[model samples]
Target: MSSLTPGVSRLSQPPTTAALTARSSTPVAERAAQVRFRRAISLMAMTLVAPGTAQLVAGNRRVGLVAFRTYLGILALGAVMVVAVALDHGLALGLAVNTTLLFWLNLALIGAAIGWAALFFDAWRIGQPLSYSMGHRRVAVGLNGVLALGVAGVLLFSAHIVSVQRDFILATFGDGAASDATHGRYNVLLAGGDSGAGRWGLRTDSLTVASIDEQTGKTVLIGLPRNMANFPFAEGSIMAEQFPDGFDCDDCMLNGVSTWAQDNPTLFEGSDHPGMDATVMAVEGITGLEINYWAMVNLEGFKELVDAVGGVTLDVKDDIPIGLPGDEVTGTIEAGTRKLDGFETLWYARARYGSDDYSRMARQKCVMNAMLQQVSPASAVKNFQGIAKATSDMVETSIPASEVDTFLDLGMKAKSQQVATVSLVPPLINTAEPDIALVHRTIRAAIDKSEGKQPAQTTKKAEAGSKAKADTGTDAPPTSTTSTTGGSVGSMKDGYAANESEDLATAC
Candidate 1:
């Protein structure tokens, strides 16, 4: 009993200095670890809130200051740009299209991204994560690494997009000043050219002048047939001086003007795009509108562009051939509403077999209208890279890069409105012997109708014609005496006419 009591007493006695020190140091170590964990968390939070602040507070002052200043400067510049865009769109567009500026902007973005990422890493290093628990250290490292990658990745991607846009702008548009609207409208000549092996320059196969109202975006598509002859040139143009009378020589059709200019380049000395310039003058004279700009799309390249956007949906009305003229037919596009790829859409716009040029022109107008209506802004952004590449490869335009935003706005407005079309062909205006005065009158009426300046004619003759068609179960021919807006001259089944209908879709 005595021995057991002593053993118990010894066990219950006060601890030694070594044992006490070990027990006390355990708690001290734990507290130190907690303090380090809290510091790391605070530093990471600071870095997230203000990118360089963590480094400024703990790591490297000079690096932090430079990064923070750059960040502030970029933010300020962005705010200014947003305000500028809101106030003056043209100025914003001008800056966006400036290649030299874009290049520097890209480099700046890359530098900022690298600097910001480095700052994050430095902040992580300064947090002394090694002194923390395994879990806490892992979390800190993960957050810092993710932030660094995110910041760098976003800016680098933005730089890439900007670079693509810059390249596209440089490739597609020439150094041409934006032209002023003439008579409250911007008359733009759009031509589709075929660049075959033996062709001299590109043949202006498809020619249309889109006369757009400056305020309302109301448009009138005035199509001139490639086969039209005896057309005059705009006054004071070199073509006018050369062909003093009309282009009345044998085989001197409207489209031939381009080839002629190309062949006789000396005749158009000092002109950069002699063929395009001459063609523009001819179209201006025929339509009685001053052209603000001209854009020529290479048809073959156009196909690639369409494919790049995935494809275009078009309401195909008839069976169209897909082969060169007088050659064995390769395929047939069945008639229906379908989404067509680049090649198919190209044929839809250019097919001529078992069809005449006049009909082809009407189909082309349909293609144009479909594209205008379907290509929304969201889709454009989503497919921007592909579109940029395609546009740069396909189109050559005198339109300034500064004016692109303006046109985009106009196009958006135009999409909401009905597209009106007028073709200078067939029984309405004899293409072989075009009456210049009548052509001008037809164009003006179409424009007026489109702008709502003039009421579209709803003739009793048209109602009677409809009734007659229903009664007879046969399509009624367009009445000769019909006094419509542009003068109803042809049925869709027969051939394309100058004054088909106020609404092109309805006419077709």
Candidate 2:
């Protein structure tokens, strides 16, 4: 046609076979390339959705069947566990504190991670990357690697966290049998203790009893000052036998009970922690509530616990000094509602430069309240390792492994309620010779109020403020005749404003 163009006034004819092939070859090639690329991605995707499905169809069937069976078995076991936990919730808790179970769980996770990763690699190999274009091969490999690493990384991380939890439970929780609640309440003695060279061994500077309702979980925090004196021990207790009538020795304050027990351990037979047992006796005697368990925290190492929970938020009523009396001040916690770090929170709870011990007790109560209310479950999970490490290192408790989950649930319940507090400090009760009868009655009333068995009573701080205002015929803060303590909002002579409050949050 080209040569005879002038004479080729003839009509156009159908395209030649070569021309047709030339026209369709590029499009056909592109479509074939697309099909191969799609097949590669589909194989990888099948592995992601159902771990050995790609291999079952396109690769070795034996390996695929084994992997698929393992995957199904794991899923079925998980479903069975969910049903078991639903029937007996305590089974989950038992597993949580079970080191043996945790160990096996860790192993299973690791094995699953390795097996799943192998399946992904096998699926990748079956994709036959060489059959695809260079660009398609690169994309498919990247996707396979991401999927493998992501799944393996998650499983490995879970194993690591579970391993940490197991270690923590092993070291921190004891294998003692759980104790039943006393009178539908569980009373736990919490103390902040310290020990050092050339110092009295294990002196608890802060002592408080958290009496929790067995059903409702409402709590009454009864704080006994470290300086409290002339208290009796529970009848038939070692301390009681030692001091037939009461602990009336000169300079033998409440906090010294632990040191005294440590000095004479022979008196506390069958007890691993003689000092803790002695303190429990004293707290039981003072509060008239049986101690279900005790948890003592090392004051120096408590900062780690605070930091582990991402620091607790507190209201700093005054500028609190970081150092003890006569020591060089390093930092100051300024007044106002503040979120405090570990160091600052430790000082806030222990600071007493210008403030007295009573104010420190009040501040410690504030810290306990803040920790209970502000520490969310999300924070616990996010900082689980830090928390586990800190607790293992800092806390010494007699809580049985079985009771850990019960208390955890109770604590969650308490967090939503307004906590009631009563510290046996000045004005309300004389620390030097505290009225034992009054202490018993006060503790009973607080617990009753928490259980809703008794009507609400005004806090001692309110009563003192009213009395002071009545005396002065003014509505000013009860700062009459003296200025406020350096680190507290109220004077030592007047009751600590935070000592006995119906609602601790506002009182602090």
Which candidate leads the pack in TM-score? 2
lDDT of 1 by residue, 325-344 (tens): 98888998877889999999
Measured against the true structure, the TM-scores of the candidates, in listed sequence, are: 0.83, 0.85
Error of 1 at 354 (Å): 2.1
Worst 10-residue lDDT window for candidate 1 reads 480-489
> What clash count does candidate 2 reach?
0
lDDT of 2 at 381: 86
Please give, for residues 1-508, the per-residue lDDT of candidate 2 as tens digits.
3664675554566678998999999788777877877887888788888888888899999988888887888789999999999998767767887788899999999998998888888887877777767888889889989999999999999999999999998788778989999999998899898746654237989999998888878888899988888899999988998898788988999999999998898897788999989999998888888999998888778899999998988877778878989999898899888788888998999987877888888889888898899889899989999999998988878898778889887887888998998888777788999888777777777777777776345444446678888999987564322234655556667766567776888777
Q: What is the C-alpha lDDT of each candidate?
A: 0.79, 0.84
Query: Which pairs in model 1 have colliding backbones?
Result: none
Best by lDDT: 2
